[model samples]
Target chain A: MACDLSPVLLSVRVALISTVLNMIMGTILAWVTENKRFPGKNLLETVIGLPLVLPPTVIGFGLLLLFGKHGPLGYFLAEFLHIRVVFTWWAAVIAAAVVSLPLMYKSAKTGFASIDKNLEQAARTLGSSETRVFFTVTLPLAAPGVIAGLLLSFTRALGEFGATLMLAGNIPGQTQTIPLAIYFASEAGDTRTAVFLVIVISFISFLITYGLNWWVDGRSSMRKGG
Target chain B: MLEVTVKKVLTDFTLEVDFTISDGILVLFGPSGAGKTTVLQSIAGLSIPDYGLIKLNNRIFFSAAQVINVPARLRRVGYVFQEYALFPHMTVKQNAMYGIKGCKDMDGRYKLSVLDVMEMLKITHLQDRYPVSLSGGEKQRVALARALMTEPDLLLLDEPLAALDDKTRRQLRGELKELQRRWQIPFIIVTHDRTELNYLADAALFLRNGKPYRVLNRNKEQPYD
Candidate 1:
């Protein structure tokens, strides 16, 4: 009875899905925010990073206001489209994406900013289109930073707790990500399962941190030595 | 043939310059901060001057009144920077072949393959090497090869030999002059060094504070030659 396999597997599945989806959105948004500075760019950056500092419950409340059953868009979706966002896997994804967005954007933006603008100018002179230059020179050069951002965002999404719990309500198999499972187990007086989840989360966090450091340091040394 | 006349007023200096080149090396000579390199940049379409005209081989590259400003890619110009600015990530071969897009030979094949120029510059063995791995002279050679491989109508070098030591600079200068003689294209060499102006220049134009002050005829009045 203590070793329930169902919820653990469900937690991993939800975490993985949320991480990958958030990473994709983070990469796209990061590239746009860093590469192109238009009117109200600062405002966009602030909005993207808002969830990082805002209370997790506040974020969940905000999402609920926008996507809950009685919420404006949520009611329309349920009535017209029959889509449920609250207490669902999709809500967990939205929560994770919101919280992890800043990590991705900051990492990618720094990476793109560090690249030499002259390289792009040279490519333009060589008859490369704007799109080609971005793909070939700019993206490759900024790749390390992008990878770093991805790892950071992935780790953040995996550990998402407050917003996930508030918005998705700790559904046993549907919305129970790793962090939520741990919280729910501890609340249910199942210290053994809670401790088990904690250890796993700790190990994952250690591995991701180590991987990011190793990658970034190795690149720096290679560049310096060369 | 390349003809250029442009003017730009910067905070510290005003750049008003004019020159022409045809099938020979033309040197822009002046002291530092003379805006000689600005003239070359303007020709390459890297920097636009306030008011002027730039025509390469009878094609107007930039004209203020006509509102014509051709981008750098369409200019078909090969610019060798003072720092070389070779792509650090690419090998010598990749750098050389960078500008050889849509090239065709007499047989309608891609003409000016990087291998030929690699051999011509004696850089065949160094093709696999990166810019960071090469010495100053070797980098200069690779940069020169890269620029010439483009088969441009005109070549612009901004103190191409300025970064090397005296011995290497002289050696490269001799090689560059000889290379110019072998190629059938207009060349513009910008440098503040009188020694380089004397050695490589077919004709020299002196710049002062972003303006052309003197046009020295190499055949008649070159002090060093």
Candidate 2:
């Protein structure tokens, strides 16, 4: 029997959306925190990074409280905006994004920090505006770290399970990602389907890791050659 | 003409500088940690001073009392860093053209053209190369070309030849002096090399402990050391 491919498709879509969101939010947050000083900066960074250490179920519970039907946000969103987010595909995306944000943030922060600040000052003296300097110099220099962060977030989102299971539920054809589908397949004595999904996930993970290694190695070699 | 009277207090020391530059090269001669770079930075609008004023060509670049601090991009000053600080990701051509595209003068025209600056610096052939691929002298020339693309009223070079070998430094010193004479803009150079002072400086300012110790005019044959 041909195995269903819907779960794989849904997983890829959710991961892609979540990774893009993480990329934007992570890069901005990293840049701001790296370059600016403000009161309570450390606290803010710690709070954003909490998800990395917290249990996924705990995060899911928090999200559940915020987005559940009787919850304040859920009630306001449903009654006023006539929109529901719980147990939906968007909920999976949000869950994955929240869980994977810290990884991107940390990597991008390091990237920005490693750049020589004198370069930016030189640009300023050359009559480039702050915005132009950032786009022309800062961002390009930090591209490798940002790209690495993006790939890590993408893979993390693809493998997300616990929070997604809690917030989005295991609704077939809607929110049943590969991880959840594999779980259900194993529990239902469908060993073949579970094995297939495990292989697919492993293969994807290998490709991502290999790609990251290749890119990093190529960059280092170019630097050495130059 | 540029006039600067600024005071900045750092954790280890306080920088109190008062100087004036009309035209030709003015060298800031001092040992390391004498706050030479700080003075240059303040003039370039990169370092904010706690008090006093910086006037360039009669325009108030910074005035603490009046709160008239123009942003760095509008200051129209070229600063070439000691490290040459070229954007490693950009080609020499892109780096040279960076300042020309974004800045505009009062009448709404670019200050200088990339082609003109690159040709003037003789770095037109290296425009397609990246900074990492260029030799130290080539990098320095590209940096100067990039800075000149803005058509600055004043040029500030912080230890411009410090990173090159002795032979390269000797050759470039003469080239730099010739360029300054041709440009006719006030050039402020920070260096500890006494020979460099004799070779290029029309005047030299001796700085010690973050303060101006003395000002010497090369024409007067004042002892620099």
- Highest-scoring model, lDDT: 2
* Model 1, span B1-225: residue lDDT tens: 888888988768998877677777899888878888778888888888899999987999999999999887777787888788788788989888876662322355356767888998989999999999999999989888988886777888988888899899888888888888888887899888888888887888877787666677755764331
- Top model by TM-score, which number? 2
Model 2, span A101-213: residue lDDT tens: 99999989989999999999988887778888888989988988899999999999999998999899999899999999999999999999899988898899899989999
Residue-level lDDT of model 1, residues A1-226, one tens digit each, is 4565555566556666766776677767777877787999889889988988999889988998989888998999999999998988888888887888788778878878888876766665665566777877788878887888878887887788888888888777677777877877898999998888888888988998998898879888998998
**lDDT values, one for every candidate:** 0.81, 0.90
Task: Give the least accurate 10-residue stretch of model 1 chain B, judged by summed lDDT.
Answer: B101-110
Could you tell me how far off, in angstroms, the CA of residue A114 lies in candidate 2 after the best superposition? Answer: 1.4
DockQ-based class of model 2? high
lDDT of 2 by residue, B3-111 (tens): 9998999767898888888999999999989999998898898989999999998999999999988988888899999999999988999888888766667576555
Q: For candidate 1, give the lDDT of residue A30.
A: 76
